[model samples]
Target: MALLGLDSALGATLDPVGVVLALVAGVFWAGYVLTSARVGQLVPGAGGLAMTLVVATLVVAPLGAPRAIGAFGDSALLGLALVVALLSSVAPYTLELSARHRLPAPVFSILLSLEPAFAALFGWILLNQDSGVLRNLAIVLVIIASAGVTLTGARRKAPAMSVEAAGTRRDDA
Candidate 1:
């Protein structure tokens, strides 16, 4: 919605600000997940998530309606946003961070291929953004292809004495 508003208000098809927002979002999210896992190493379960939300709320506070807080107090849309945020942002972040600590990056990335499917399912259920069978099948195919790459890459036998301690290292033994 924010992106749609920006695109419409600016009369822009594609713009740097939008591109930058997307890039920054992806970069920060990747860092947030990886760093959250590291922070978990230092803290404990959900501590990193709590800290992330604290910082994120601080950053987004000014952008959220301060004066109209009472307006959203009983809004179904606001409630939906809160629920979606919990599921899409908070839950996924924690799960990905925890998984990144255990799974190889390629494996994790491949596992993330399922994200679109879940998102689509949620969109259909939550927002009624339903798609036809062909579109859904296409999405499934893409996910399967991505998973194939991840699985094949993870299964590759790497030579010994090659940065074995890294999280991305293969357990080829």
Candidate 2:
């Protein structure tokens, strides 16, 4: 609903194909989170991430390698690619794997939803993309929502642990 409202505010029509692609991306994201968490539990952090990246590169290389090779002649593009790989791929995966070890799956997933809000802020600041008040407010709301869930969820677990500890004390007594 917030998306639809934002779209309406922007005076933009929704593209069905784009919406379907977004849905597909969301499903893939969910899969990535669940699989990453399980993998993080089973395998060591950096090793699992390195294996995942190798597989991902192998999967994508056939399609992208030709174009990438052609573009490699440009030193600026090569530098950009290196920066992108470090910032967008390596850093995030490392942090995400570490987070998976520390956070519950649902909380991590809720935190992951903050990506769009951060993306919007980056786009506005970096790319000079849409600076409309409504769009900015929507991004703020997303950040607030994600933070609210994380804080409230963490608090809820505290009481349960306290209750369990209290029960254990009574049992010991």
TM-scores of the models, in the given order? 0.55, 0.73
Error of 2 at 86 (Å): 1.5
53 Cα displacement, candidate 2 (Å) = 0.7
**Residue-level lDDT for 157 in candidate 2:** 80
lDDT of each: 0.73, 0.80
Minimal lDDT window, size 10, model 2:
1-10
Worst 10 residues of 1 by lDDT: 1-10
Q: Write the residue-wise lDDT of candidate 1 on 10-127 in tens digits.
A: 5536666887998899899799657765786887667777787889888888887676487587788778878988996788677766787788778777777777688779899999
TM accuracy, model 2: 0.73
Predictions: Cα RMSD each: 8.0, 3.8
Best by lDDT: 2
